[model samples]
Structures are given as structure tokens and as C-alpha cells.
Target: MKPAAFEYHAPATAGEAVELLAEWGDEAKAIAGGQSLMPMMLLRLTVFDHLVDLRRLHELRGIRQREQAVWIGAGTTHSAVGRSDLIRQSAPLLARATPLIGHAQIRNRGTLGGSIAHADAAAEYPAVALTLDAEFELLSPRGTRTVAAADFFTGMWATALEPDELLTGITVPEWHGRRGFAIEEFARRSGDFAMAGATVAVGLDADSRIDRCAIGLFGLGPGPERAHHIEREVLGSHVREVSAEEVGRAATARLTSVPADLHGSANYRKRLGAVLVARAWQRAVEEATDD
Candidate 1:
């Protein structure tokens, strides 16, 4: 199947792209790597009268290191992100999650912003972004603004982005001190989307007590979810004193909207999520303690 007929507009500047999107409104869609959009379009799941191509916009395609956080342009490919030294050193969770996105061919053509904007509950990038507390930069005719990861994702395949807004970049803050990051997911096959997954980031004090932690869960709810209640439970507790199984149970117990589908029931997903979270928690704590 082929996509429905659409006018393709390649804009050299982000401002031009924003204007095009603003002008077309609901009739248009901004396309970056087109990995996810093209598939849906081909399947006739979605239709757009116009496609605002952003490939030519140089402003949305680089990685930069800031004083405290690393800024990744929205158009940066998953392949580039995986290979980036800055991303590996400054934001290791994002780097670790990159390879699990899909196969090499898919990652080669998929962009970071596209993944987050698509907001798939089963995708690795969105969960990682939430775990790291990343910030998204948005541009529109009205001007620019930033949205925190917590508020950006509204539901499955939906976001807080307005019709005319373009996601220009992402800022992932660096975690200083004794810290560890890990991502674990249960996919049926190497390139398959995860059935359930968890991304864990832990920070420890000198005495090996958990100072801060973030547990990001995906493939278990309407959108990527944070295990806030679990984090609060483990904070200030000695790493050895916290049981991974107990933490996992607490995290999954707090979930209110686990999705059921052909793959599994909601209860099944919650169970899988619990195991993954426990595994990730153990791994992250081990690393943090080693540091």
C-alpha cells in the first residue's frame, strides 16, 4: 500500500517549516526521518494533505554540550545518537536505550524528536526521556517555549505540542556524583517492540544510600510512566536495604492504566513490568555502588 497523495514541502529553515505547519494546520504534518509516519501513512492509518519536510533545516540536526546538560537537536538520527560520545558520557541512559529502538536500518532513519513526538508507550526513547527528566524545546508562530518530559506526553500517540509547534531540540540534564543508569525491556525478538520495559537511573551518596532515583516504565500504560511512588520509597534508603522485588511490586502496584492487547493482558503486562523493573533496579544499584 502507498500513502495517500500529499504535497511535500521541503523547508530550508525551521521558521519556514513552522509557518508551513501553521498555514496548513490539521491538513499538514511535519516529517523528520519519516520512519514511523511513513509506515502509518502507507497503511492508511493516517492521512495528511501536506508534508513539511524538515531535513534541510540545519538548525535541527546537531548535538551540543552545555554547561550542565546536553542538547540534542530534534532531527538527530537514532544512529547518530547511539554513536555520540557526548551522549554516552553525559546521558548514558539515552545512549543505552538507542540500540533497543529497532533494527539498524530503522535506527538509521529514525529521529529522536520523531520517536518522542510519536509518543509510543512501547518505545525506548520516550521512557528514557522521562527517566532522565529531559526538556523539550518547541517553536511556533507564537514564539518558543520549553516543556518538561513529565507534561509533554498526554497519552498514547499524543503530546502537548500544539498544531503549529515544532519540536526543535531536547535537553537532558547531566547527573553528577555517584550515579548509574540502566534500561531493561522484554521484547519477543531482537527488533520487536517491548512488551514491557523499565529504564532506571540511580544516584547514591558516599555511604551508598540512594539520594535520588527515577524509574521510567513503558509498554505498560497509555504513555510512558514514571514510578514516582517507588522512587520516594527508595530515596534515602541504603541500597542494600532496598529489595529489588519489593520495589518492583510497589512500582507496578501503582499503575492505574496498564493496557491489554493481542500480545498480553493488562495483568500479564504488569507482571512483566515488575520483573523488568526489579532487574533494572538491581543493575542500576550495582553500578552506582561500584562507582
Candidate 2:
């Protein structure tokens, strides 16, 4: 398979990248890591006239930790984030979710920003980003603006990014050492796209009652959806004594008519969704206790 004819431009700086995107508009697409885009290009699923290579941009290649949050460069690879000492120690739920993305080779080349921009409904980054309430930095010729993760994904393979916008980086609140988190996905193999997935992030108050929680799940909707009903159900109780199965059932029931595919029937996926959510909640509770 071969990609359609396209101009390849590697820019060494974010400014150059945005300028080229401004020049080419819809004909140009940003290429960072190429873990997802390259395969699509080979299939001719996307016909780009220009690929603004972002690999050489040193500025978009590292993770930074601030007192309040963590900044991940758009060009940072999944492997990098998974193995990063800073991310593993501080935002480990992210590190936990990365390996679930794909195999070693794919992880080695996939960029966090690229995955979020791609917005695959079955992908890990989207759910993780949503779980963290992350914000994106999208750059265009006019300027840069931040978009909340919840407002980023519009639908399958779609985002709020404009035609000329390039996602430069993401900012996520630091874990704050008060939460217990878990990520679980059902895939055919070790690195296959998730058939169903769930991530639970919960914070406990001094009374051990759930204070706040975020549940991000995928493979049952147009995009990742927050399990608000489930979170609310658990917020006033201790996870150990709460009826997690009931919460899981309610959450799974809401996805009764999920879209189906060769990997799973809608019913089967719904079942997996319930199971994953339950297990993730259990793990989160244990971790919260330990914390």
C-alpha cells in the first residue's frame, strides 16, 4: 500500500509548523510520531497534499512538572510517557493507560497529542485526557487557544481543532496525591484496539467518603463518555462498602445500544463494559485505601 501523493515538510519549530499549516490549510496535515496517520495514509483513507512533520521540533518533545500540573509536549511518544519517571511517579494513571494503547512499535511512535487529535472512539488517550480534565494548546496562524478535553472531541475521528490548527501540547492537573485511579480495557490481543475500556479516578475526603470522581469510558459511543451517573452514585459513600456492581450495571445499561463491530456484538461489549468498570472501581478503592 502506498499513500497518495503528498508534499512532506519537516519543520524544526512550532512557529514554522503553524505557519505551514496556515499556508496549506485543509490540504496540509500535521504529522507527529505518525503512529496512526501513517497507516491511514497507506490505506489512502486520508489524501493530504502536505504533511507538516513535527518530529524535529525540540520544543514539542518533553514532559514538564509544575507545582499544580503536568505539561506534555505534543511530540512526546507513548513509550516516552509510559517510561517517564516524572509521569510514572506523579500521574501514574496516564502511564497505566499508555501501554493499553498498542504494541511496542506503535507505542514507540505514537504521540499523545496526535492520538488526542485523532480522537478515535476506542483509543486510550482520549479517555485518559478526559479523566484528567486536560486542556489542549492548539496553534494556528492567528494565535493559540486552550480547549478543555470534555469539549475537544466532537465525534468519531473528529475534534474542535480548526482546519489550520495544530495541537501543540496538553496540560493536565497533577494527581495531587489524593486520588486512586485505574484503567482497564478489553482487547483481542495485548495491543489491539479496545473493544471496551474504562478508567476510574477517585478522590477521598478525610471521612473516607468519595469526594470527587471521574469515570472515562470508550468503545460504546461516538466518543469517550464520562460516567456521571456512576460517579455521582459513589460520591457520598466509601468505595469498599458501596454497591459498585449496581453502579456498573447502571452505567452499562445506559450503553445498551452501543455500536457494534467484528470485534464484539453490542451486547457483548456492554457486558465487558460493566465488568471493566466494576474491576476498575475495585482497584481504585484498594489504591485509595493504600494512599
Candidate 3:
């Protein structure tokens, strides 16, 4: 099977890309890396008549740090972000979760903005972005708009992006060595999509006690979502003394019911999700405490 015939345009700037989108209207689709879209197109799941390529757009291709956050250009590859020492030091959660996204080949070509825009529930970016409260920069023919990660995802395989909108970048808050972050999942293969997974980034205080925590799990909902009760319970507790079982229990209390597919049954996923949450939090706490 082949993708439908389409005009391909490699735009030099985001504006030019927007213009092409405007011209093509509903027939146009913005492509970056094409790690995800290419497969969908070949399967005939996607049928765009015009392909707007953003690879030539130089503006969306760098990582910058500010007092408040790190601004990752839309074009930055997952492998680039994963290997950057700065990202590891500043936002280790992203670094830790990147390798879990897919294999090296996919990570080398897949872009952060593309992953976020693609909004795959089993993907890592959505979980990390949601955990960190990252902001998305969307550019359109009219102007630009910023969307918070939580609000950006509406449902399965869906996002807040409009037909004419192009995601230009993502802004992640700066790390203050608050807490250590950790990730865990139960998958059959090294690079396989998680049947169930969890990511925890916690910040500790001078007293070596938990200050705050963000917990998210994949394969438990429409997308990776916060384990709200677990976060609330973990706050103020010393990381070392916390039990993985307790953390898992808290997560199960909130996200016990989720959709089930070929991965596992809803019951099995719910129980396993709690376990992953506990382990991820405990590992994150230990990491933070060790430093």
C-alpha cells in the first residue's frame, strides 16, 4: 500500500509552512521526522493530499535554557534531547524516558514536537510533558497560542491542535535539583511499547524529605496521566522510608479503571500500573536522595 498522491513542500520557515497549510486547507498535513506519520500514511490510515515538510525550517531546531525553563525547538530529535548533558542535568526525566519511547533508529529521526502533536497515549513525551507541566507553542496563520500540557491532550489519538496549527516548540520548566526522577515499565521487549509504565520526578527539600512529586503512567488511560493521590501522599515523606506497595496502592485508587486492548486486560493493567507507579516513585526518590 502507498500513501495517496500529494504535493510535497519543504518550507524554509514556519510561516511558509503555515502559508502552504492555508493554501492546501484540509488537504495539507505538516510532517516532521515522519517516524509516526509515514507508517500511518503507507497503511492508508492517513490520506492527506499535500505534505508540508518542516525539516528545512531552521528556526525550530535548537535547545535553549532560561531562568524559568528550557525551550526545546519543535525540530529537536528525541535522540538529541536524550543525549544532551544539559537535559540530563536540568530535566533528567525527559532523558530517562526518551530511550523507552522506541528504538535508536526511531529516536534519531523522531522529533519532540511531532511526538507531542501525535499524542500517542503509549508514547513518553506526553507523560513527561504532563508531569513537568510543559507548555506547547502552536503557530497558525492568524498568530500564536500557548497550551499547557494537561489541557493540550483531549483524548485518545487527539490533541488541541487545529487543522491549520503547527507546533513550533515546547517549553519545560527548569530543574532546581528538587527531586530525582525515575521510570519503570513492564514490556516484553526492550523497545516495545509499554503494556504498563510509570514516570516519577520528585523534588526534595534540604531536610531530605519530599517537597513535591509528579507521577504519570502509560497504558492506564487515554494518555499518560498524573497519579494524583500518590503525589499528594508522597509529599513531605522521606523518600527512603516510602514503600513501593503504598505508592502503587494510591495510584490504583485513582486510575484503577482504564481501556484494555491486546496489551492486557483492564484488570491486569490496573494492578500492574499501581506496581509500576510505586517502583518509579521509589526509584526517583532514591536517586534524588543519593545526590
Candidate 4:
């Protein structure tokens, strides 16, 4: 199927894109990479009178450390993110999670901001962003503002972005050293959307004990969700003594309150979520404790 006829506007700057959005409002859609928007457009699930292409916005196209956080241009490709040494050193959780998004081809074209804006409940980036407490930058005619990842994703395929705003960048705190991070998902194939998944990040104190931890769950809720109860349970525990079964049981109790779905029963998804969480926690602990 072909997308509906629309006027195309390629903007070389975010300000130019914002101007287009301000003029067209709900009738226009800002497209970066087209990985998410184009498919929906072709199926007519959504329509636009104008398409604002953002590939030429060079201002929004790099990854660098600013203050205590790493700012990634919204236009940065998943492939570039997955392969970035800077990301690997500063925010390894994000680097680890990027390859889990889809196949190589999908990663090649998928933009970080595009995925975040799309807000796929089972997508890797949203969960990672949430786990990392990432911040999103939104530009509009009004001005630019930042939104925390926790508040950015409001629902499945929904975000806090106003119709006239464009996502310009993402900021993640630098994870320095002595940190463990992992991403795990259950799916039928390599590129399939996950049936269940979890992204985990842990910071160990000098004593080699869990000091801080963040767990973001996907495919088990309306949107990416932080497993706060589980994080609380694991804090202060020694990495060597961490128990997957205990963590899994706790996660099951917390996540199974919802109804079932066609992909799996609510209980099944909860179980999957628990197992993934446990696996991620264990792996992250190992990575963090590595000499």
C-alpha cells in the first residue's frame, strides 16, 4: 500500500522543522529515518498533509558528553549508537540495548528520537531510556524544553510530544565505571517485537554491594515501566548473594495484576518478565563486578 499524497518538506535545521510543524499543526508529521512513521503512513493507520523530513538537520546529529550526561542527537541512527565507543564507555546500558531493537537493516535506518517518539511498548530504546533516566529535548515555536523519560511515554504508541514539537536530542547520565547493565527479551525471532523484556542498570558501591539500581520493563504494560518494587528489594544486597528465584517471584507478584493477552496469558507474561528481570539483574551484576 502507498502512503496518502502529501507535500514533502526537508528541513536543514530543527528550527525550520518546528516552523513547518507550527504552520501545519496536526496536519503535518515530522519524520526522521521513516522507520516508524512510513509504515503507519503506508497502511493509512495515520495520515499527514505535509511530511517534514529532518535528515538534513545537522545540528541534531552527534553524540557528546555534556556536563555529567551524554547528549545524543535525535537524528543519530541505531547502528551508530550500537557501535559507539563513547556510548559504550559512558552509557553502556544504551549501547547494549541498541542491538536488541531489530535486525541490522532496521537498526541502520531507525533513529533514536523516532523510536522514542513512536513509543512502542515493546521497543528496546524506551525501556533503556527509562532505565537510564534519560531526558528528551523537544523544540517548538514556543522554545525548547526537556522532558524526563518517565514522563515522556504516556501510552502505547503515544508520547508527551505536542503536535507542534519536534524531538531534538536525548541526554543520558554517564555511567562511569563499576556499573553493570544488561537487556533481555523473549521473542520468537531475532527481529520480532518482544513478548517480554527488561533493561537493567546497577551501580555498585566501593564495597561491591548494590548501591543503586534501575529496572525498566517492556511488553508487560501500557508503556515502558520501572520495576521500582524490585529495585527496592535488591538494593543493599551483595552481588554474589543475589537470587534470581527470589527476584522472579517478587516481580511476578507485582506484574501479574493485569489481564491476559493473545500473545500470552497475563500470568505467562508476568513469569516472562520475572525471568528476564532476573537474568538481566544477574548479568548486570557480573558485568559490574568484572575485574
Task: Give the higher-TM-score candidate: 3 or 4.
Answer: 4
| Most lDDT-accurate candidate | 1
- Per-residue lDDT of model 1, residues 110-200, tens digit only: 9999999999889999999999999999999999999999999999899999989999999999999999889999998999999999999
TM-score, each model? 0.99, 0.96, 0.94, 0.95
**Candidate scoring better on lDDT of 1 and 4:** 1
**Residue lDDT tens for model 2, 1-291:** 999999899887898988998899899999988888999999988899999999899898899987688899988999999999988777778999987888899889889999999999999999999988999999888999999999999988999999888898898887654578899898888888898998888888777888888888898888898888877777778656786687667777876448797777889888889889888887887888784
Q: Model 3, which residues run further than 4 Å from truth?
A: none
Cα error, candidate 2, residue 283 (Å) = 0.4
Candidate with better lDDT, 3 vs 4: 4
lDDT scores of the candidates, listed in order: 0.94, 0.87, 0.86, 0.88
Q: State the lDDT of candidate 3 residue by residue for 124-198, as single tens digits.
A: 888889989899999999999999998999888799988888999999996686567888888878887788888
- Once superposed on the true structure, which residue ranges of model 1 sit more than 4 Å away at CA? none
Return whichever of 1 and 3 wins on TM-score.
1
Comparing 2 with 4 on lDDT, the higher-scoring candidate is: 4
Best by TM-score, which number?
1
What TM-score quantifies how close candidate 1 is to the native fold?
Answer: 0.99
